[model samples]
Target chain A: MDLATVTARLLKLATKVSDEVGSIISNPELDARMDRVPANLGPYGVDPFGFDPEYLKKCMGMVSWIYHNYFRCQVFGVANVPEGRCLLVGNHSGQLPFDAAMVSTAVFLEREPPRFVRSMIERFVPDTPFISTFMARCGQILGTPENCRRVLSNGDAILVFPEGVGGLNKTWRDRYRLQEFGQGFMRLAIETASPIVPVAVIGAEEQAPTFINAKFIGKLFGVPAFPITPTNPLLPVVGLLPYPTRYRIYFGKPLQFTGDANDEDEVILKKVDEVKATMQAMIDDGLAAREHVFW
Target chain B: MRILITGIAGRLGRRVANRLRRNHEVIGIDRRPCPALPTDIVHHRVDIRRRPAEDVFRHAKIDAVIHLGIIHNFRIPAEQLHARNVMGTETLLKYVSKYNVKKLVLLSSGDVYGASAENSQFIDEDVPLMASQRFPEIRALVAVDRMVQSFFWRHHDIETVILRPTFIVGPNVRNAPSKYFRLRVIPTLMGFDPMVQLLHEDDLLRMLDASLKPGLRGVFNLAGTAPVPLSRILKILGKPTIPVPAPIARALLERAWKYRLTSFPAPELDHIRYNTVLDTSRAKEVLGIEPERSLYEILEPFRAEDQADYTD
Candidate 1:
């Protein structure tokens, strides 16, 4: 079998095994870390998964394969990601979640011992058995505020796209301009007292120029939104795969929120805007440096 | 005396500075620092989107303002355009009103009329403005005009005047026609002999000068006396005039836009293709301003300079 087929099959088998054994391997100490935490603090509880170095390596291997064969992405400022609980806030690009994958690779490769991202999974992913099992084993949880707080409090680095679906839905016409961000991540960061590191990813938007999002079709397919691309509809099978695009991942210095966690909503909103502005500048600088959509 | 000019380094700002500097000190603010202007004119670099107008104006002992700063391109997204033009204007107006500025001379556009083939004839100041229906850079001018007018009329202290000029042109023109000139491409002349009306930079300055004088209020069209054929202007610029069908031209333009090869075509081009024209009777009668240079006269000297420079 070719490398891709072998890798895909291995990933499937590994995920199945990990999911079946994950509950048994759960550490009691990690669960007890949340014993004294307020139940009404948020809608979720701390569900910490131990970070296995080998699993992280395997994940990085997958990332390397995808980057070489598909994206050929280059990442920078990977050193800025702290080893402990931190918020990775990045400007969302492309309709697909390629930016997330690139960042995940960067963190894994650049971290001293290599680390895995405590990411938020979409609710729909869990419906598919293989995808859910894989994501769960990988330690990516649902994107609720409660989950974010739990992850951060457990000393795990969490990545959140503050702009949420709006950022992903933006078209080529509105490239680099940030859509309005949700304030939940900011609130979580403030409450957890985690440092927010702004990341900007360029060239993802050009990989598959998602110009339209047909809601009706997306609903029927049980996906978030059906991304309508210029090539995809016309080319079918090959079109679904993102065009190989060079990528630049920039990491801005971490911003600390010194204010009280229970600060007024207006104050938190201002802080959120400040972080958004910093991310926007990074995006603008990234775009200015590159000549083509891919590069 | 302190005066705030939003686009202080712009053509009209320069003219207004020259004309008014003798009496009142003009404080100019723009996105870039203006080191070229005279030392006496205090300049501030600011982005209208984020910077608070109160913070900028509170420092100055400002008396009045000539709010000229705006994104003229209609191809930009509506939010961006609104943020820069509509919101920027509103912020400045609100701040100036709060601080009790003496007067405001708002530079509006003749495109506010929502020009079309039906309104090709001499459109007056009272002509109803059609709502901007185009995507991304829709017409928010009428709303802007109403907002400015209401602020002045309803508010207690501030005085305001609005000058709507048609295709203001001069050496410093950085927009549409100049951009086309820079690209060395003739903009598609959609099979219609549409009359083009333009106000020379000097003439626009003259209108601003009139508005600055006491007792000027309400909207006025500031356009040249006569309109000329767009085809004739294209020929003057040395661009090979190709009469491609409008559909093909649009398709090519769209492709160019996708690749970021060229600036998106202005919504006004749609009106231009359909032979939309503007009336300048108000500018003539009320402001006592007449366009000094015709399109041919303006281009002739530039064309000669260009030929000499290239040959040398």
Candidate 2:
């Protein structure tokens, strides 16, 4: 081989080695030391490292890369995110679940110690090997009521897309529209007496325009989409990459539901609708105020 | 009679305006200016949520309002949908009742049928309005219907006609089944034989003509008699059909719902998946008018346009 070709092959080998090392270092067991909390902070009742701050910082860095490089996100109204145990509800966009990453990064950057968001994980994530381990250690759990209540009671900020899977799965044609939200979050908040903060994230939809979803293949593949999306699913090795687009996180004022905790279902549903309306309005206003649809 | 048509620029609104123009002295009210209508059809530019109802209503000797302006998508934000569809309707109803308008015609969609499996094949005016578990727009419309029903029953001498339409197919639908059909790619079965109900915009106007007839009041399902498959409609357009696996299709739909791809599936995909069909016999019986165009006929105008130019 020529001198240049040999040099290029050596560089490729070096990159592969470094990637493997990085992957090994990111393993949950290797980073178990990050979970250690300092003894001096016991009086404050805050276990700073209880969540593995180093791993969190690394995750935050990854999130920053995704937001800045991939989504080019510009977040605002993060100051409206309450200090503790508040339910953060925002408008979800795109088929892939990147809004959670953006919101998590925003909270991490805004808050001093960076409050961890209790997120809902897909069934597939936990079933996977490496990703499952990292996600579990990083603090994302199933969005069932039991977990939501547990997370809220323990004074952790919970982020939920009340519209659930429907909101994120919206097509390119229905961009910026808030789908019907379920009453679970409202019920959880009322049951736990936690405040609900409405957040509006504008400009995530333009990054990836999903016009049509072919469902039959998605079921066979055990994922939402098997062949479509910006990243080809058949090429699973590189399927996780998201298309870059501008993102803005707009946080609205917190809405506290002080009605009877044991209120009837009708009342709770009404309150849930009200909260959804508030969040929808914030999203509309945010989009309207923007000079361009995409940043 | 002095009438206010909110979406005067729309297909149904223009038809309603055209039908009511000479006899009723109609005053058209729209968010955008319409150059097609005659000058006598009074036009006003105001957002129902942001503009005062009195200011819009006080312009003439307003007798009734045809509320058609709304952001019609299930994936739309609850607040915006509420503000435009629910609050705007509420504001219009409140102002019209306050002004002692004789009647109001509120345009509602058959999507109020939340879950298809729970609903009977034929939904009538008396069918119970159930809240949708998936779509927020339907919930908002349900709220609008409740508000209108309560206000008309208790508050004033005002008469209200709630028209629930099923899959309105025409030239001016701006989006949806129209956009999908224009692209020659509507999700359908292998045989293209899923039953569908549609009403031509012109026939819908004729129904509006009947709605304005003396002493007409009550809810009616305005749709066509026969059901047509989406495949047949695409065949009429002569567009190539691509078969997608159902599971992958649903996942893609869910993804589209997340990203706001197509407006039709976001809030109503579950219902569509279950083949939600509406009974429009009440419209035929009460309105005494049959829609002129069939599903195939509705696709004619766009069929004439080059397929390449129909990009959404």
**Model 2 lDDT at residue A114:** 49
Q: TM-scores across all candidates?
A: 0.47, 0.47
lDDT for B285 in candidate 1 is 77
Task: Give residue A276's error in model 2 in angstroms.
Answer: 52
Best by lDDT: 1
Error of 2 at B94 (Å): 1.4
Q: What share of the true interface contacts does each candidate keep?
A: 0.00, 0.00
Kindly list the interface RMSD, in angstroms, of each predicted candidate in the order they appear. 30.3, 23.5
lDDT of 2 by residue, B1-312 (tens): 888888787766787788788788887666776887887776777766666546867656788788877656656677877777777887787788777788888877776766443333345677677746656456788887777777767854677888887777777776565666666445642221233566777777777768877578888888763644344456567666676544566677778777777555644435333334566767778788867775556767767455544322
Candidate 1 segments whose C-alpha is farther than 4 A from its true place: A1-295, B10-15, B47-52, B59-61, B73-77, B140-142, B181-187, B235-239, B266-268, B301-312
TM-score of chain A of 2: 0.77
DockQ, prediction 1: 0.00
